[model samples]
Target: MDWQEISGNWVLIPPRPSAIVHFLGGAFVATAPQLTYRWLLEELAGQGYAVVATPFVNTLDHVAIARDVLNKFENALDRLYATKTLRKAYFPIYGIGHSMGCKLHLLIGSLFDVERAGNILISFNNYAARDAIPIVEQISPVFNVEFTPSPQETNRLVQEHYQIRRNLLVKFADDNIDQSILLAKLLQPRFPGMVAIQTMAGNHQTPLGQDVSWPVGQVFTPLDAIGQWVKQQVYRELNQLKREILRWLNPLS
Candidate 1:
């Protein structure tokens, strides 16, 4: 699947879409959204989902970043409508987020009136700067800088403000940083619609790339089953992830 950007938006437009998905990546780098979420985005695109992936610089000020996501979504929609690529842009809009991306989507759902159809949160976490990066703990005193929406602040905001209807929280088996439990705990009280938590067979980085080192631009031996086995193993986690997302998004279908 090939997609070009319009007005600083990377849009993966499918021929016909079951839904429109806005993809948000994790923290640390302000790199290209397609670069980090390529595997997941491609899979979702193949499954008839139009995905708009946006990049952002990770910062302590998460509230501002959340607002930026909303702005990016609007800009992408503007471009799609102007180009006439979206014949009918009335499909339900969904937000899919990983790590810090999950926090941003949750913030948007809570604070903004975006009318999101659903939200898929994977491995959500809101760590203080000191805990998020152990090294930062050592130097925090020198800069007197603190991470905005620290763990405590994140919990408080979501507990009081989150208002999304349909949500699917995913947790991996071996991920210590799987903070879905905490997020589910906070949402159970306020969320009126379906709030489901699912555990899959992978780690925090499972949905990001589907594999740790291989299957990414690897030169394989020119054999059929050998290559196919490796390919399946490489993307097992993400394959399952995509399937789960489709099931949740269109349960009746």
Candidate 2:
């Protein structure tokens, strides 16, 4: 697999024992100019946490592109794990994704179901809402609401799609408020303490864009204010995780 270094400043935060932190990029974008998390990485390394960022090309077409990028990331993780880097026995791995990257994270996280595989999604939205237009068009011709598929059959099909939508929303909330709520619900069942969602006030692209001021200082524009908020949140979460790891390793005080 061809791997590309996401152009931008990247810093590695060393973790005690040895843990891996994976940073996933957004859709149609390679890396953010601000290089969000540089400060966090330094802080984490100081506290004994190893951090790494894998830059992948963001091509928004088929799922193969995302899968390929994620595969490359997984390979990097394998290398790190083989090197005997972190403190945790199972290699505590956390994933941070923005926008479409968040969707990719869910797909990968769900597929792997690793022991310590935790995830943080920023600016996550209901996948259905984001792709509603296309989904509707695709299924519209299959089932005619006016005639074919009978009432029972129509109900089943509609219910199936509805469930899919529900799952998407539950996995990724459209805005910060609802997004946090959705994340809480989803994690409570499978990973009560492992999942976290911090909804910063911004649209989808905020986490990737560094600057918050643009398009007349409005939240909607080329980028959103949430971009800064997401970066700050990532740093905070990484540092917090590092502290917890330190505390775990050295409990007596």
Candidate 3:
């Protein structure tokens, strides 16, 4: 299905969607999530989900970014309901985020009054400006630039204010910058048994499925066989990721 823009967010809704997923991508690629996360979001839409991927420019004020995206997502939902694109019947909403996006979702859940069935936080990263951005690192000492909430302040807020109970913290095996473990530690205490963590095999960029399709010829050559094998391996990890997400999203199923 083709993606449609609703209230400044990229949306893909199938007929009679079972759930709504509010998605946020990583720091840089968030500006074009429709292109960057096309494969994963389209897969979710195919699985009977109304995917609303909100694109935001990375800023130091994560709190403000969270509020802005939340507002846009709500507006898009309202339009979908009003236009009869989605049924009037209740559909559970879930927040899914990657890298820096995870921190924004956490802030929204902590500071706003939004309801979510649960949140699937993948590769949650809350790093200081110096560490996260190289240019910022070079100029920070001279210009004094830093995130508004700061990494420490963000943690404090999550520890003291985050309200959502059910959470699935996904950590990647080879992601050096991932901080899902720390997030899980903070959230587990607040909600106890409600917080669960899953470690996957791929790295941080696993969600960004670069699905390159190569055509096969009638006279299959060695290069064709190698290309096909590579394509299968690339999609295998993505398919596994999708299955795990679906399992967590619908545990009873």
TM-score of each: 0.90, 0.49, 0.96
Give the poorly placed runs of model 3, Cα more than 4 Å off.
219-222
> Per-residue lDDT tens digits of candidate 3, residues 1-253?
7899999999999977899999999999999899999998999999999999999999888889999999999999999989999878889999999998899999999899989999999999999999999999889999989997899999999999998899999888989999999998899999999999998888989999878979888899999999989898878877888988999999897
* Candidate 2 ranges beyond 4 A from true positions: 1-18, 32-46, 60-62, 81-90, 128-180, 190-253
Compared with the true structure, all predictions reach lDDT values of: 0.82, 0.44, 0.92
Cα misplacement distance, residue 151 of candidate 3 (Å) = 0.6
In terms of lDDT, the poorest run of 10 residues in model 1 is 210-219
Q: Which digits, one per residue and each the tens of the lDDT, describe model 1 over residues 189-211?
A: 78755789999998888776734
**Most lDDT-accurate candidate:** 3
Query: Who is ahead in TM-score, 1 or 2?
Result: 1
